[model samples]
Target: MQVLPKGVRHIPGFLDRTRQEQLVEAIRLVVAEAPLFVPEMPKTGKPMSVRMTNCGSLGWVTDRDRGYRYQAQHPVTGHPWPAMPDVLLEIWNAVSASNKTPEACLVNFYSEEARMGLHQDRDERDLETAVVSISLGDSCLFRVGGNTRGGQTMSFRLESGDVVVLGGEGRLAFHGVDRIYPNTSTLLKHGGRVNLTLRRVNP
Candidate 1:
């Protein structure tokens, strides 16, 4: 077992091939309805490298003007996000210690060149709830640091079907994808990585 920072648990190949394919198909349905849209950084309005969409009742969204917040509808389509798939809820129930079910599942589609800067997931009203992340498609180097920026950090490779749980003291840790390795996996049809982050938006 790889030793990660406190409260950070990395479960490699947590999902079998069959389950991974099922998740991919489920996300495909989600994208067909919600569609992925580019997210922008607050103030600067810098566009994020990856395209994003969401599932579940609440969806995470960001724009230069309003910043990061959870909304009931998509930014461009103005339609309510599709409901959270039952498979995701089962994963949360099996892993997340909290009794509350996730209200939002942020779907991030990262191309070969897409990379995310290290940041904390603090938009949620309750920080006590855990953040459950499921990795599918290509592999990427995931970087994780302590609660504060500039703190000690570590990098590890996350492949398809990997599951990571950020809970307890690690709930607010800073983490991000350094870069995506193209053709690393055959999960996604066209080749890319899909990251599904499940979180409790409200207290």
Candidate 2:
């Protein structure tokens, strides 16, 4: 078994098949209210491979002009983000190990060819709060490294229903998705992966 960094907890099969299906339905409602939009890299305006949206009080967004930041309204819809689902709140309460509630649930959908570069989630005001990531649908090669860029890294498969928590020393870890394994699972009707990241944006 590969050992993860300090404070980085990986729980395999955290959610059962039924729960995963329920969460997918909940996310469908969220996407209906706040459609998934393409996120762009700062300055270069390069589009990311994943399509994203969010729920909760604040949503994370990035663009060539504004860069990475949290906002209350969707960039495309210009409406307040939908409320965080109770199912997500229950999961956070169960595994977050924090007293405070999460204020943003960033939803990312990865196609078979989608890939994410190693990056840190540092735009939020509260760095101490842990980031909870829940995976559904297909599995993917998830990579993680130390806090510093260009450091040694490790890779592992994050299958559907797996959960990862980045807190304490590992909260600022550099992590990303290497690639998606096509037709890995049947959880999603279309055979893509959906990653839900729960975070506390403010202190």
Candidate 3:
């Protein structure tokens, strides 16, 4: 009952090695209730080496004068964004063929010298729902492209409970994350790499 290949998916052990250690203890309680830093790239505030954080109910951020945006709190601790762990909304309503229940998750942390260039996530407010991603710990290099820029490119390695699904028009296609292979997954305990992106943010 694992899936991932409608254009790109691997689903290696699609969650259930005891729920993959309960999704790594629910992402370490959402990084201890939103507590990871290293953001400041807005208009040259300069300081992004991938270390951001978030939970549920909205929490994606950026600063280089705003390139990406999502907020409900926590722009440096306004205190409010952290609660999407009912096992990640039951794995986003069971892989969401179209049951969508994601109100923003965007918790990305990577560190074997972090890397996430080439981007494209169109400020989610409407893209026909579905951008569900959830690859935890090590094994990177997940590049995807289309919607015109050379029109075709692909890469994969995803691993660790891999579950990626883009929507309508490939949910605006164009993807990122192309690095980090160091110490490739010993099953988390501090080694870096966590990407939980569940979208649909309209407030």
Which candidate tops TM-score?
A: 2
> Model 2, 1-203: lDDT tens per residue?
77898888999999999999999999999999999999999999999999999999999999999999999999999999999999999999999899999999999999999999999999999999999999999999999999999888999999999999999999999999999998999999999999999999999
Each candidate's TM vs. the true structure?
0.98, 0.99, 0.30
Compose the digit string of candidate 1's lDDT tens values, residues 1-203: 55688999999999999999999999999999999999999999999999999999999999999999999999999999999999999999989998998999999999999999999999999899999999999999999988999898999999999999999989999999998989999888899999999999889
lDDT, candidate 2, equals: 0.96
For candidate 3, write residues 38-104 as lDDT tens digits.
7876688888778878888888887777746888887777898878888888877876566657887
Model 1 residue 110 distance off true place after TM-score fit, in angstroms: 0.4
Among residues 3 or more apart in sequence or in different chains, the pairs in candidate 1 whose N, CA or C atoms overlap within 3 Å are: none
Give the TM-score comparing model 1 with the true structure, all chains together: 0.98
Residue 67 deviation, candidate 1, in Å? Answer: 0.6
Per candidate, the number of residue pairs that clash is 0, 0, 9
* Candidate 2, backbone clash total: 0
State which candidate has the highest lDDT. Answer: 2
- The lDDT per prediction is 0.96, 0.96, 0.76
Residue 4 accuracy (lDDT) in model 1? 84
Candidate 3 contains a number of clashing pairs equal to 9
